[model samples]
Target: MPELLAHRADTEPDRVALVAGDEQVTFGRWHARAGAVAAGLHARGLRPGDRVALHYGTASWHDYAVACTGVLRAGLVAVPMSDRLAPAEVRHVLTHSGATAVLRSAGRPDTDLAWSATLAEIEAEAGGSVPPQPPSPRDLAQILYTSGTTGVPKGVGATHANLAHGCTLDPRRRPLAHSTHFLHAFPVGSNAGQTMLVNALNARAAALTAGTFTPGRFAKLAERYAAGTIFLVPAMAIEMLHAKVHTTHDLSAVRLVGSTAAALPPAVALQLAAAFPAATIVNYYTSTEAAPAQTSMVFDPERPGALGRPTVAADLMIAGPDGRPLPAGEVGDVWLRSPVAARSYYRDGDASAEVFRGRWVRMGDVGRLDDEGYLYLVDRDSDVVKSGAHKVSTLQIEHALHEHPLVREAAAFGVPHPVLGTAVAAAVVADGTLTAPQLRTFLLDRLAGHEVPGRVLFLDRLPRNDNGKILKRELRQLLDDDRATQ
Candidate 1:
C-alpha cells in the first residue's frame, strides 16, 4: 500500500487521485500527509501490527484516504468502519476486531493519544521522514466488513498482497484500462467502496464520486466530468432508471456501465442498454469474501439471466450437497478460487473454516453454470423459497416483477405455509395501481406457476440497508403482519 502511494506521488504528483464532489486530493499531498500521519502514530507509541480503527463517512474521504495510507505506511492494520453504521454495529466491530486506536472525523481537539485521535489531530503530526517500518506485501493491510444483513457482520482480513494482487505501476497495465475517469457512488466501508479506493491508487482513471449517493446527482456528476466508465450497485441502477436520468442527462460518454453488489435484473439491464446506447452494460458478481475471484459479464440479450463467466485467471465451480463439484446445468452452491491467497474472518476460525476452503471462497449463493460456462445465479441460500416439493428463486420472481410496467421496486421472500413447507410472497413499490391478480398474471407469462409469487403487497417503498440492498427480512415481517391482521 505504501509503495503504491509513493509510486503515484513520484510519477503523477500533480494529478488528482481522488475526488468527492468539488474537492480533490492529489497524489503528492495525499502521500505526504500519510507520511506525516505515520510519524504521528509512531510518536504516539503505536507500534507496527497494532490495529487502528478508522470511523469515517464519504464526506471524509480525503481524511480517510490519508489515515488508511498512514496506517499501512506505519505497518499497522486498518479497520474501516463507515459512519453510517449503527452505534451497536460500530461497537461490535470495534470490540470484535480488538482495535487498539480509533480515528474519526474532526469534531473536537484532543491530545494525540494512543486510544483515539481526530483527523485534525493526525494532520498536525509534523514529521518529514517515512515511518522506518513499512509494510510488506504479505502483511495484513485492512480489515473490511460484510453487510451483515442476515447477522453480525464479519470482518474480512486482507493482506496487502490480496488487495494489490493485480495492481501495477505500469500505465498500460492499470485496472479500468479503457477509461480516463471512472465514476461511482458506492458507500464507504463497503467492498465496492474499498475497491474504488484501490482503483484510485491503481486505476488509469481518476476516481470520482458525489460522496453521499443520490441517483440524480450521480448521473449529473458523470455528465459533468464526461466519465468514460461508470460503476454502481443494482439499487442505484434501479433508481436512476426509475427517474430516467439518461433522458435528462447525456450519458453517452460512458463506454462501460458496471453494476455490482447484487445481480442486476434483466429488465433493468435492458433499460440500461437503451439508456446508455453507447455503453456496454456489465454485471459484476462477487462477494466481499470472494473479490478478485468473480465473474464479469458484458450484457448480452441472447443469454438472459447469465452473470457471465469467471474473469481472467479465476476459476468457478458449482458444488452439490456433498461439496463435490457438480456438472454443468446442475443447481447448487457457488464457489470461486481466489486470485490471491484467500482471506479469512478476523479472529473467527470457525467462520474462516466454513467460508474458506484451500484457495476457494464459498459465495453462499445458489447458482449453476450453463454448458457455455456462463454462471446463472438462482438465488442466495436464504433468499431461495421452498414451495412444497419445488425450490424457487426469489430473484427470478423479482426480475419478473421488475418487468411489470407498473412495478417500480420489488422484493420476494418466503412465508410459512400450512401445507407447503414455505410459500412465495412478494412486496412491490408500484409506479401506478398494481394488484395481486395483475402481478400474478404478469408473472405467469415469465415464470413457472410454482415460481409465481402467491402473495403481493403494495408499498410506497421497500426498506433498504445503508448500502442500498433491499431488506428481505423487513419485507417478510410485513407479510407476517398482514397475515396476523387477516
Candidate 2:
C-alpha cells in the first residue's frame, strides 16, 4: 500500500485524495503522514504481523485513513471497527481478532484494552521511518468483522494481494474511471467504506465522505463537489428519495450512482433512475469474504431482478446441496470466485471450511442464473420461510412492499407457526398512512398466496447495522414484543 502511495505522491503530489467536511488530504501529505504513523507504530514496539485494532468514529475519516495505510506501511495487520458500535460489540472485535494494540481516533469509544493510544497522541511523536519490508502479497492486510446479524460477528481476513488483486497502480485502469469526485456515506469501518478508502488511494477521482450522514448533508456535499460518482447502500438510497433532497439540490453532476451491501429493490432502482436521470444506476453484489470478486448490474427494465454476471475477472457458480455446480436457471447456493487470492475467516477452521470452498467463496445466498448467466437471488438460506408446503423468499415480499407508493422501507421475515412450522411476517416503514390489509392486498397482486406476509407491523424506522443492512433478528424480537403487549 505504501508503495502505491509513494508512487502516487511522486506523480501527482498535489492532487486531492480525500475530503470530509473541512479537512482534505493530497496524495503527498497523506503518504507522508502515513509514513510518519508507520514510524510511530515501529517506535511503540509494534512489529510486522502484529494485529492492531483501529476503533474510529465516522467523523475521523481522514485520521483513520492515515492510520490504516500507516499500519499497512508498517507491515502490520489492521482490524477496523467503528466507534458507533457498542462497547460490548467493539470488545468482541478487539478480543476476537486477538489484537495486541487498539488505535483510536479523537472521539474514541471506550474499551479495556491494555495498550491503547489516540491517533492524535501517536502523531505527536515524529521519529520513525517507513518499513523497508512492506507487506508481501500473501501477508495479512486487515480483518473486517461481519455485520453479526446472526450470532457473533466473525473476523474475515484479507491479505495484501486480496486487497490489491483487482487494483492497478495506474489510475486509468481503476474502476469508475470517468469521475472527478467520488462521494459516499458508508461508515469508515464497514466493507463499503473500506473499499472507498482504497478508491481514494488509486482512483482518478478524489473521495468525499460526510462526517455525519444526513440526506440533506450528503446531497449538499455532492452538489458542492459535483461528485460524478456516488456510492451507497440501499438504505441511504431510500432515505435520499424519501427526503427528496435531489429535488431541492443540484444533483445534475452525478454521472453514476452505485448501490451495494444488499439487493437494490427494483422499485427503488426505478426511483433512483428518475431522481438522477443523468446517472447510470448499478447494483454491486458481493460479501466481505467474497470481495474483489463481485457481480454488478446496471438498471435494465427488461431484467429488473438480475443481480448481474461475474464482473471482469471474477467467476460465479450456483452450487447444489452436494456442492456440485448447478446449471443455469437452477436455484442453489451462490458462490463467487475472487479475481485475486480469496480471503478467509481469522482463526476459525470450521467457518472457513464452510465458506471458502477451494478458490470459491460461498456467498450464503440462494440464487439462480438466467440462460444468459445473469444471477437472480432467491433468498438468504436463513431468511427462507418454510410456511405450509411452500418455501417463500422474504426478499421477494420486501420488494413487493417497496412497490407500493407509500412504503418507505420494509423487511420481511418468518415467525413461528404451529400449523406450517413458520409464517411469513413483515415490518414496514411507510411514508404515509398505510394499513396491513391494504399492503397485504397490494402484495397479493405481485406475490403468490403463500408469499403474502400474514402479519404486518408499522414503524417509523427499521433497525439497521452500521453498514445499513437490516437486522431481521431484531425485527423478529420487535414483533414478538409488540404482540405480547397486544
Candidate 3:
C-alpha cells in the first residue's frame, strides 16, 4: 500500500484520488499526509509488526483511509474497528488483538491502552522519508473482525499479498476499466470498505463516498459525481428501490451496479435491473476468509437468483456431510479455493481449524451447483432449522415471502414445537393487512405444505446489525415470548 501510494504520487500526482463530501484530495497530497502519519507513529515508538487499532466515530472516509494507509506505511498491522461496536465488544477486540496503540476520529476512549491519538494528531507530524524497512507481501497487513451475529466476532488476519493479490499499479488493467468514478457507502473497518480502498489505489476510477448515507443522499451523490459504478448490499439496494431514487435522480452514468455481503433477493434484483437499464447488475458471493475468490453473476433475467460460476482465479465446490465432494444439484457445504491463500483467525486456532481445510475454506453456507455450474445458495448452515425429519432453509422461506407484493422484509426461523420438535415461524415487515392463514395460502401455491410458515407475525422492521444482516437470535427470542404466552 505504501509503495502503491508513492508510485501513484510520482506518476499521477495531480489526479484526484478521493472524493469525500466537500474534500477532493489528489494522490500527491494523500501520499504526503499518509507519510506524515507514518512518521508520527514511528516517533511514538511503534515498530514494525505492532498492531494498531483504528476506531472512528465520524463518517470521515478520507481520514479513515489515511489512518489505515499510515499504519501500513509504518510497517504495522492495522486492526480496523467499527464505532458502532459496543463498549464490551471494543474491549474484546483490544484485549484479543493486543493492539499497542489506538487511532480514532472521535468519541471517548473506549479501551484501556497505553497510547491513543486522533486522526488530526496523527496527520500533524512531519515525516521527511518513508520507513527504512518496507513490509513484504507475506507480512500481516490487517486484522478484520467478522460481524458476530451468532457469537463473538473473530479477527481474520490478511497478509499484504492476500489483500493485494489482483491489485495492480498499472491503470491499464484495472477492475472497472471503463468507470471514471466508483461510488460506495460501506462503513470503514469492513471487508467491503477494504476492497474499495484497494480499488481506490489500483482502479482507473477515483473512489467517491458520502459523509452520511441514505437512499436519497446516495442517489444525489451519484448524480452529482457522475459515478460510473456503484456497490451496495442487498438491504441498501432494496431501500433505494423503495425510495424510488431512480425516478428523482439522473443515473445514466452508472454502467455497473454490484451487490455483495449478502444475497440479493430476486424481487430486488429485478427491480434494480429495471432501475439501471443501461447497467450490468451483478451479485458477488464471497466471505471475509475467502476474499478475491469471488463468484460474480452478471444479472441474467432468466437466472436472477443464481450466484454465478466461479471466476478463473477461484475453485468452488460442494462438500457433503462426510467432507467428500458432492455432485451437482446436491445441497451441502460450499467450499472455495482461490489463487490467493486463505486467511486465518487471529489467536483462535480452534475456530480456524474448523473452517480451514488445506487450501480450501468452508464458507459456512449451504448451497448447490447446477449442472451448468451456476451456484444457488440455500441458507447459512447455522441458520438452517431442523424439524422432526427435515431440514428447512430459512433463506428459502424468506425469499418466498419477499415475493409478496406488500412484504418489505421477512425473517424465518424454527420455533420449538412439542409434537413436531420444531415448527417453522416467520416475522414480516409488510404494508397491507395479512393474517397467518392468508400468508400460508400464499405460500401453498409456491411451496409444499410443510414449507409454509406456521406462525406469521408483522412488525415495523426487522433487527439488523451494522452490516445489514438480520439478527435471527433476536427474532427467535420474539418467538419464545409468543410461545410463553400460549
Candidate 4:
C-alpha cells in the first residue's frame, strides 16, 4: 500500500499535514490519531477486507484523513458514501456494502441510519495508542460507488497502488510546503476528492476542507486561509460565476485551480479562466472506474470540447464497436489502460468483466482523439439519441446549445416514440431572453437537422449529483411528465 502519514512523520515529524477551520495537525499527531482510530476499529472485531463506511463531510479534512488512513492501516476496506445522500440511498449503500462499522460527523445522528451512532461510539471507546500494520500494494484500499447513471450503483474496488499512481501528477517537481494551504470544496470520499487529498499530502500542503458548495462562504474561507490551491467541479465553477463570489475573496494566493468530475462547457471555462487570471485552470476528465484521462491547462474558445492530454501513465485510445482501435479523428468508445484503474467492482464478477478487460478498462464513454492526441468526448453510449435511422450525439448538440449566448447549461436525451422509435428532447438553463425559436436558429448553423432537439424545456438549473454530473434520469422523467400533461 502507499505510505501513510505515519511513515512521513518518522522522517519529517514537524510538518503540518491538515489545517481545517481553526484546527492544525502535524504529521506526527495525525499519524498517532490514525493509529488510535485503527486500534479502535480492530478491537471492535473488524478484520481485513471488512467494509467500514465513512459518512463524514469535507469540512474536517483531517478527520476523514485519519479515518480513511485508519481503515487502510487496519487492513479493512473503506467505503465512502456521500454525505448528501438521502436516508434511503444511505441505507442502500450501507446494506449493499455490508459495513461492519461507520464513522460520521459528531452528533449528526439524523443523517445516520439505524443503530449507526451506537456502533461508532462502541468503536470509539475502544480507541488506544497503537502502531498501524503495513499493507501490501495490492491490498484493497477503497470501494467507491458510481453515480448509477445507467442503473443501480456499483462498487469499484481500488488498490493502494492504484490510489498512489492516480494521485501523484508531477513527482519530479515538488509543490509548496505544508504552510501553503488549500480549500477543498469537493467530496472527500469521491475518486477525484481522494486524488486531491493524495496530491496535497505528496506536496505537504495544508488543506481546509468544506462540507458543501457555498460559493460565497467557500470564497470567504479561501480568503481567510490565504489558500494556495483549490480543485472545483464545473458545476461549482458555474455557481461561483453566478454568485460572483470569487471576486469577493483574496484569491491572489491561489496558484492552481483544477476542475473535473463533469464536462466543462466553453462559457464556464472562460469565466473561470478570466476570474482566476494567475492560477492555471485545468479541465480534467475521468470515470469512477478509471484514472483521469487528461488535464487541459490552456482553455481556448476554439477547442472548447478537448479534455487535453493524458496526465502521466495513462494510455488512452478510441475503440470501434468491433474492438478495433480507432485512428485519430475517429469517434468511438473511449478505452483506457492505467496503473491507477480499479481492480474490479466489489463482489460483482459479471459487472466487472463487462468493463474490465484483464488490463484495460472500457470507460463506456464515446469520444475521439485529435491529430495532436487530445481526447474529446462525444457522449455516453447510452446518451446516443437513436431516432429512426440517425444516431445523434446528445453531447455534441449540448455543446452547441451551450455556445448560445443565452443558454447556461443544456442536456439532450432521447424520448420514446411510436413512429420514429425515439425522439430527441432537450432541457436547458438560460439567463437571457432566448426563445425556443432563437435557440433552434442558433443550433441550425452548428448542428444537423436530425441532431437538433425537438423540444426545449427550460429549468432554473440542471439537476446534478454530488460529483456535479447532470442527472439525465431526472431529465427523462421531466419529459415523461410533460407528455402526460399534454
Candidate 5:
C-alpha cells in the first residue's frame, strides 16, 4: 500500500488524492504526512508485525485514513475497529487481537485499551527517518473484524496481496476511469471503506466522501464534485429514491452506480436504473472473507434479478448438501476461489477450518447459477424457510413485497405451524395504511399462491444490523412475543 502511495506521489505529486469536507489533500502532502507518522510510531517502540488498533468514527475519516496508511508504512499490521462499538465490544477486539498500541482522534473518551495515543500526539513525536522494511506480498497487512450478526465477531486476517488486489495503477486500464471522482458514503472500518481506500491509491479519479452523509448531502456532493461513479449500500439507495433526492440535485455526471454489502432488491434496482438513466446500474455480491472474488452484474432490464457472472479473477460454484458440486440452477452453498489467497479467522482454528477449505472459501450464502452463468442468491442459509415439503426463499418473498408501492421495507422468515410443519411469515415497513389482507391481495397478483406469506404484520421499521443487513433472528423473536401475548 505504501509503495502505491509513493508511486502516485512521484507521478502526480500535485494531484488531489482525497477530499473530506473542507480538507483536500494532495498526493505529495499525504505521502509526507504518512511518512512522518511512520517515523513517530517507530520512535514510540512499534516494531515490525506489531498490531496497531485504529478506532475512529466516520466524522474522523481523514485522520483514520492517515492512521491506517501510517501503520502500513511502519510495517505494522493495522486492525480497524468500528467506533460504533460499545465499550465491551471494543475491549473484546483489543483483547482478541492483542493490539500493542492504539491510534485515535482527540475528544473521544478513553477506553480500557492498552497504550492509546491520539494522531496529534503521534505527529508531535515525528522527526527521524525509519529504515525501510517493506512488507512482502504474503505478509500480514490488516485484520478486519466481522460484524458478528450471528455470534461473536471474528477477525479476518488479510495479506498484502489480498488487500492490494485490483490495484494496478495503469490509468488507461483501470476500472471506472471515466469518472473524475469515485464517491461513496460508507463509514470507516467497513470493507467498502477499505475498497475505496484502495481506489484512492490506484484509480485515476480522486476518492471523495462527505464528512457526514444524508441523502440530500450525498446528492449535493455528487453535483459539486461532478462525480462520475457512485457506490452505495441497498439501504442508502432506497433512502435516496424514497426521499426523491435526484429531483432536487443534478446527478447527470454519474455514469456508473454500484451497490454492494447486500443484494439490491429487484424493485429498488429498477428504481435506481430509472433514476440514473445515463448510468450503468450494477450489483456486486461477495463476503469479507471471499473479497475480490465478487460476482457482479450490470443490470439487465430483462433479467432484473440476476447477480452477474464471476469475473476472471474469481472461481465460483454451488455445492450441495454432500459437498459435491451442483449443476446449474441447483441452489446450494456458494463457494469462491479468487486469485487472492483465502484467509482464516484470527486465533480461531475451529472457525478457520470450517470456513476455509484449501483454496476455496464457503461464502455462507445459498445461491444458484443459471445455465447462462448468472448467479441468483436465494437467502442466507439460516434464513431459508422450509414449509411442508417445499423450500421457500425469503429474499424472493421480500422482493415481491418491495414491488408494492406502499411497502418501504420487508423481511420474511419461517414461523411454526402445527399443520404445515412451518409457515411463511413477514414484517413490513410502509408509509401508507396497510393491512395484512391488503398486502396478501397485493402479493397474490405478483406471487404464486404457495409463495404468498401466511402471516403479514406491519411495522414502522424492520430491524437491521450496523452493516444494514436485516436481523431475521430478532424478527422471529418479535413474532414469538406477539404470539405469546395473543
Candidate 6:
C-alpha cells in the first residue's frame, strides 16, 4: 500500500479531495496540508514510530485525514480516539498507547501534552514536496479503539498489509478509477470512515466529507458532487429512506452503497434496493479489528436474511463448543482469519491473547454458513440468554418480533427469575394498541415456546450508542426498575 497522501498526489493531484459545506478542497491542497502537519509534528520534537492521538470530531475531517496520513508518511502510528469518551478515558488511552502527543483543534487545552494548529497555519507551512520514505508493508498504520456492547474498548493495532487486503474486497475496484469521487458522511475519526478514506487515497479516488451524517445534507452532497460511492450504517440508510431525499436529489451517480456497524433490517435493505435500482447495496459483516470479511453483493428482492459469502481475501470459520469448525448450517462462534485482521491490541497482552488466537479472531458473534456458503449471524455470544434449561438467542427473538407488521423495532433481553433462573423480556416500538396477549399471539406462529418473550415492554424508540448499536445494559436497568415497583 502506498503512503496514503503520496498515493493520491501521484495519481490524482488535480482531483477534488474534500467537499465540506460549501467549500471544495482539491487533492493538491489536501496533500500540501498533510505534508505541513508532518513537518509541524517533526519540528515539535516528534520522531519516527512515535504515536500521535487525535482527539477531535466531525469538523476536523480534513485536518484529521491530513494529520493521520501524515503520521503514516512520517513513519508513526496514528491513534484515533473517540471524542465521546470522558476525559479520564481519553487520558487512559493516551497513556496506554504511549502516544507522544495529542493533536486537537486550536482551542483545546485540557489534554495532557497537546499540540494545536489551525487548518490555515498547517497548510501554509508545507509548501514543497515531502521526501519519499522507503515502504515497509508490515508497518503499523493505525490503532483504533472500539468498545463493543460491554467493557472498555481495546485498541486494535492494524498494519499496512492488513488494510491493503481489505481494500481489495471492494467489488467496484474497477469502477473506483483514479479521479472518481467518493462521498463520506461518517465521522472522520471513526474506524469505518477512516477505512473509506484510506481506500479513496489508495485508489486515488477523490474524497468528499460531509460535516456529519444528516440524510438531507448527505443526499445534497452526493447530488452536488455526482459521487460514485458512499458508506453508511443502517440508521443512516433508514434516515435516507424516510427523508425521501432520493426523490429530490440526483442519486443516479451512486454506483455502490456499503453499510456496516449494525444489522441492516431486510425491510430497509429492500427499500434501498428500490431507491438505487442500478447500484449495488452491500451489507458487509466485519469489525474494526477485522475489516470487511463477508459481504452480500446480490440485492435480490426474494431473499430475506441473506448476508453474502466471504470475499476471496478473507478466511472465515464457524466454530462450535468444542473449538472445532462446525459443518455448514450449524450456528456457532464466528472466527475470522484475514489479511485485514489486526496484529494485536496495543500494550494489552492479556486482552490480545484472549481475542487473537494465532491468526484467527474470535468475533464474539454466533453464526452459521448455508450449504451454498452464505453466512447468517444469530447473535453475539454475550447477548445469548439461557433460561432454565433452554438456550435462547435474543437477536432471533428480536428479529422475529420485528417481522411482525405492527412492530417498528424490537429488543430482547433476559430478566432474572427465581424458579426458571431467567425469563425472556422484550421491548418493542410499535403503532396501534398492542396488548401482551396480542404480541404473544403474533409471535406464536413465528417463535417456539421457549423462544417467545414472556413480558413485552413498549417504547417510542430503542436506546442506541453513538455507533448505532442498541444498549441492552440500559434496557436491563429499566426492566429491573419496573420489577422493583411491581
Best by lDDT: 2
TM-score of 2: 0.97
TM-score of 6: 0.89
Residue pairs in steric clash, candidate 4?
1-136, 1-137
- lDDT (Cα) of model 5: 0.84
* TM-score, one value per model: 0.95, 0.97, 0.96, 0.90, 0.95, 0.89
| Candidate 1 lDDT trough over 10 residues, lowest sum | 106-115
Candidate 4: lDDT of 252? 83
Supply every candidate's count of residue pairs whose N, Cα or C atoms clash at under 3 angstroms: 0, 0, 0, 2, 0, 0
Please provide, for model 6 over 1-486, each residue's C-alpha lDDT reduced to its tens digit, 9 standing for 90 to 100. Answer: 345456556666787766566656676777766677776666666777788887666666766666676667666788886566677778777877888777765665556455545545654665553534733778887788875468777788888777666444333553366236777676644667766666656554566777667888899888887888887887788668767889999999898888878767777777788999878888877777666444554655565576776665247788887778988988899887765545688778998877787677878888888887777778778888889898898877877886776776778898888889988988877767777788888889989998888877777777876676778888878765543212
lDDT of 5 at 39: 86
Global Cα lDDT for candidate 6: 0.72
Candidate 2 vs candidate 4, TM-score winner: 2
Per-residue CA lDDT of model 1 for 1-486, tens digit only, reads 789889999999999888876788999999988888898888777888889988888888878888888888889999988888887788887887778888888762222333678856766764544476678888888898889888889999999888887789887788776766899877778888888888899987898877788878888999888899999888888889888898999888899999999899998899899899999999999888998787989999999789998765238889987889999989999999998888889989999988899889999999988888899999999888888999989988888898988888888899988999899888888897666887787788889999887877778888888777888888878875553211
Which candidate leads in TM-score?
2
Q: How do the residues 1-486 of candidate 2 rate in per-residue lDDT, one tens digit apiece?
A: 667888899999999999877898999999988888888888888899999998886678888899899999989999998878887887788888888888887655446664888876776664644454788889998999998987788899999888876567775676666767899888867888888888888788998988778999999999998889999899999999999999999999999999999999999999999999999999999989898889999999899988988755238899899889888888899999888788999999999999997679999999998888899999998899999899999989888999999999999999998999999999988887788888888887899999988888888899998999899988888885653211
Off by over 4 Å in 3: 107-110, 126-130, 480-486
List model 5 lDDT by residue over 82-163, tens digit each: 6887888889998999998989888777666678889888877987757357778788889888878788889988988888
Off by over 4 Å in 6: 1-4, 113-135, 166-180, 203-205, 247-250, 292-294, 431-436, 480-486
